[model samples]
Structure formats: structure tokens, C-alpha cells
Target: MLISAEGRTYRQEAVAAAVIGYRFGASKVRVSIEAWLPDNRRRDVDNLLKAPLDALCHAGIYEDDSQIVELSIRRAGLDKANPRLEITLEAA
Candidate 1:
């Protein structure tokens, strides 16, 4: 969460939108995710997408997460040094 000087706490979706400089407004969406993990430990991919999807909504890429009609996720292998997530969002 990011707190504004005005005392508004920005969500991860809003922060990511501001950082990536992208926005969308579509009735339906498809998302592809690549998660680079720090270790080989197993985790649920669905758990990791909530914040990002929320961020997309905050960025006005869509009116709400319910617009996301398709979703895909995959492990992009290990990144012991700098784990990160890569996402691709498509609207229809």
C-alpha cells in the first residue's frame, strides 16, 4: 500500500499501473502470468494474482475484476537473486 500526502492509501493495482504506465477499459480481459520464484517451493499461482488483478482494476484497465474472463499462469523458473512477476493483460 502507498499512502498519499492526502491520506489515501493506494492499492497495489494503482501503484503498479502508475509504475508501468498502462491502463485499460474493456468488458472482458485475458491475463497471462509468469512468476519467477526465489526458490523451488511450491505455491498456488492464484494466490499471487489477486493484488495484480486489483491493480489492473485500479488503473481503470477494466471496471472490475469480474471482467477478467480468462487467466493463465506459469512458473518461469527460479530467480534466487531477484524474483519477480511478469504479466500480460489482453482485453476484448
Candidate 2:
């Protein structure tokens, strides 16, 4: 099965983020994810919208904020064997 995920899973980074939020007394910390949907940039797929959220675990966490994030006129990691999808996270 194929799947896509977005999280600051690195143990140290996640821990540090939590620590910072705690220090600031953020009761309801905001975990925001800014991501690019896809870059099939071939000019042939207009409705090529992908549900990258369906591939994410925290899809419902911010359902009321925004549904998805998308990138345009750009392509990432066309040379690597396994490319990573980047999603920005701001916790707190």
C-alpha cells in the first residue's frame, strides 16, 4: 500500500517543540501544516487535484481551518529515488 505522511517525527525536534510550547504556557497549541499537494506540472492535468490529506494521519485535526495545501508551477525532488513531501508545522 502507498501512503503519504506529514509530521515532525524526529524525536528531538518534536520534544523541543513541545518544550517550547510548554514554556510559553500555550494551553491550546496550534499545530499547523502547510504543504504542497503535488507538482505534475505538465500543463495537461488541470483537475489533477490530489487528496494528500487522505494520505495523512491528522486530517481531521484541522478540518474547520482548511482542507488542503497546494503548490503550483513547481516540482520537487525529480532526481531522488524517494522524494519526500514537505509540510510545514508550527506547533504553538
Candidate 3:
């Protein structure tokens, strides 16, 4: 996932802090991601994960993305008007 400046800004402003609050330490972790897109847009899950995972790291949710021991990705149907991404990070 190549995040542009605007996208990085959005993640920093909108999600970083929340991820920090929801997470614990710099321990090895497991992550599950579910992205409910707004339309029938084709997206690469691996590519999609790069930015958010980077955001989580920047938020201090973990020391680094390398700390992720197990990762799962799902293209969870479409939510049209309410497209959203759900991420679950747990101690591994």
C-alpha cells in the first residue's frame, strides 16, 4: 500500500490515537483485517494493509510492523454507504 501524503494525514488524524488506546505494548502481535468497501472495487488486500499497519506502528500500537506474527485479511462484502475497515490486533 503506497499511502500518499493526504492518506497518511488522514490516518494520522483519524486513527492513530484510537489504535494506541486500543492496543497494549510493543509485543509480537496477531492482526486480522476486514475491509468492507463501498463498491465493487477490486483491491489487493496485501497492498491495502501496508498503510493501516504503518499507522498502527506510528500510533505506538507496536514497535514495528515486523512485530506482527500472524496476519489475516478478508474482503468482507460491500457496505456501500458505510464502507469501513475493521482491524483486530492481539498479543501473539
In model 3, state the lDDT of residue 40. 89
Best candidate, lDDT-wise?
A: 3
Among residues 3 or more apart in sequence or in different chains, the pairs in candidate 3 whose N, CA or C atoms overlap within 3 Å are none
Q: How well is each residue in 28-88 modelled by candidate 2, as lDDT tens digits?
A: 2233333333443454322322433322322332333243333332333343444433434
Better lDDT candidate (1, 3): 3
Task: Encode model 3's per-residue lDDT on 2-92: one tens digit a residue.
Answer: 7789987967764645743766576889999999999986778788787778777777777788888999999988999888778888898
- Give the candidates in order of lDDT, highest first: 3, 1, 2
What lDDT does the true structure give each of the candidates?
A: 0.74, 0.34, 0.80
Off by over 4 Å in 2: 1-49, 65-73
User: What are the clashing pairs of model 2?
Assistant: none
Cα displacement (Å) at residue 91, model 3? 0.5
Candidate 1 structure quality by residue, lDDT tens digits, 1-92 = 76454423436535654565545665688889899999988799778887766666766667788887889999999999988788787765
My TM-score estimates for the predictions, one after another, are 0.72, 0.29, 0.83
Model 2 worst lDDT run, 10 consecutive residues: 20-29
Best prediction by TM-score: 3
Off by over 4 Å in 3: 1-3, 14-20
